[model samples]
Target: MPVHRPGTARREHHAAGVLLAVLSALALLLTLPGAAQSADGENVPPRGSARMGQGVLEHDGQGGEPRGGDAVQTEGVDVSSHQGNVNWSALWSSGVRWAYVKATEATSYRNPYFAQQYNGSYNIGMIRGTYHFATPDTSSGAAQANYFVDNGGAWSRDGKTLPGALDIEWNPYGAACFGKSPSAMVSWIRDFLTTYKARTGRDAVIYTATSWWKQCTGNYSGFGSTNPLWIARYDVSPGELPAGWGFHTMWQYTSSGPIVGDHNKFNGAYDRIQALANG
Candidate 1:
């Protein structure tokens, strides 16, 4: 879970084209909101994925344009999928105010570089920092929380990291890896969050993609209002935010960007995010 607060559905019909069109439109709107919105008030992107906003990342085919810190805003990215092979100094030089590093996955797997990279960055002073877990399909929210607490080296003397996150994305593990049900998932997540809160004495945050929420966990209603949300919607811009979430702290709007000294491309976001994070 993330500090920012971060939903949808379908009918019983054979509408593959319609579904693709809808998702495509949404992606376009999300990736290119400025281009799509016109004087006629008609968005060019498809349906379900529209609402792109500024700060959305872009790729230039061969490579991406490097974007770092400016007097204008904060910059950050998701390093969960990214192996610990990043150049921390490049990001620091690029004006990275925060970092959401992937620390653990469920109970068995851990980010090989979490311990080294997390502490490495913290020691060097990278503003605020946090960790997110790669949730597994099986129900083991407590174990996941424990993994983060135990291994996530970055934390305040009080216990929790400056912020903590739950990276709940679509189950890419196939059908068997499918969810246990929205309610069950919510229960599991709540359990993990509560466990973390008890240990750290801070509210846990949830990070998720927009489509996952819309189709799967949009209606989840058990958590308290204090929980924050961190959402990921890669569109043309960072437009149309989710409504169900009462609070949101961060928005991961881009997936590709130019950062200093990194072997591969990276992601970035707007500078005004500190306001959104309330930091």
Candidate 2:
């Protein structure tokens, strides 16, 4: 017969209670907002230097030919503070025509190299525009839009200044969809678009990946008629677009182009790019 000691039982119960308490605390921590766990189960904070296409490059692999099967397309590139002091002359010499510079993010971050990248592209005769990295989890879309406009996302009829683009993709910091449900995400986007148009009188361009769009926004299509879509897909072709968009206005074909930043394609010829800027 096995003899059960009273003290042993009491000690075992106390140890089990401690273990359970620890586990419960861990579970609660994981449920907290901005709590992110890596694949190896390590907690990781959000990256502060999130740039244009950072999520796309992280989720989607690089390398691909431009889609549209040999159709006429104007080349472009998108840059952030990562590509400090871009060599605009070299990109211009490489047949690049249009550029998008990272402007503001979540109303908190403004690209330090915005002036150089934005003006250098324009000075090099490239139709250049700005983009705002959306962080719907941090602030209201309208507030972020106002912040973007005040910083560098304003539009002009200079015939070389393209309307700003809203770069909404996977959250590099925490939850992929910023912890919002599909409908809530859609509403946030609508608010941003509405406010952007009100501030600039131009429908802002939307830069997104189809997979992220479908997963986050439930494949919302309401913006297709107004916002120009800048689709990011690094493959032999732009696989499939999100709902409502009949065609992509811009396609980011490759992240590892022979240039400084991610290379993209304006869906039409150089004249179309100029037309978009002129608008």
Best lDDT among the predictions, by candidate number:
2
Q: Count the backbone clashes (under 3 Å) in each candidate.
A: 40, 0
Runs in model 2 deviating more than 4 A are: 1-47
What lDDT is reached at residue 236 by model 1? 36
User: Once superposed on the true structure, which residue ranges of model 1 sit more than 4 Å away at CA?
Assistant: 1-73, 157-161, 221-224, 260-279
lDDT of 1: 0.53
Candidate 1 on 45-80: residue-level lDDT in tens? 321121111112221112233344342435665564
Highest TM-score against the true fold, candidate: 2
For model 2, name the residue pairs that clash: none
Model 1 lDDT-worst window of ten: 47-56
TM-score of each prediction = 0.62, 0.84
How good is model 2 by TM-score? 0.84
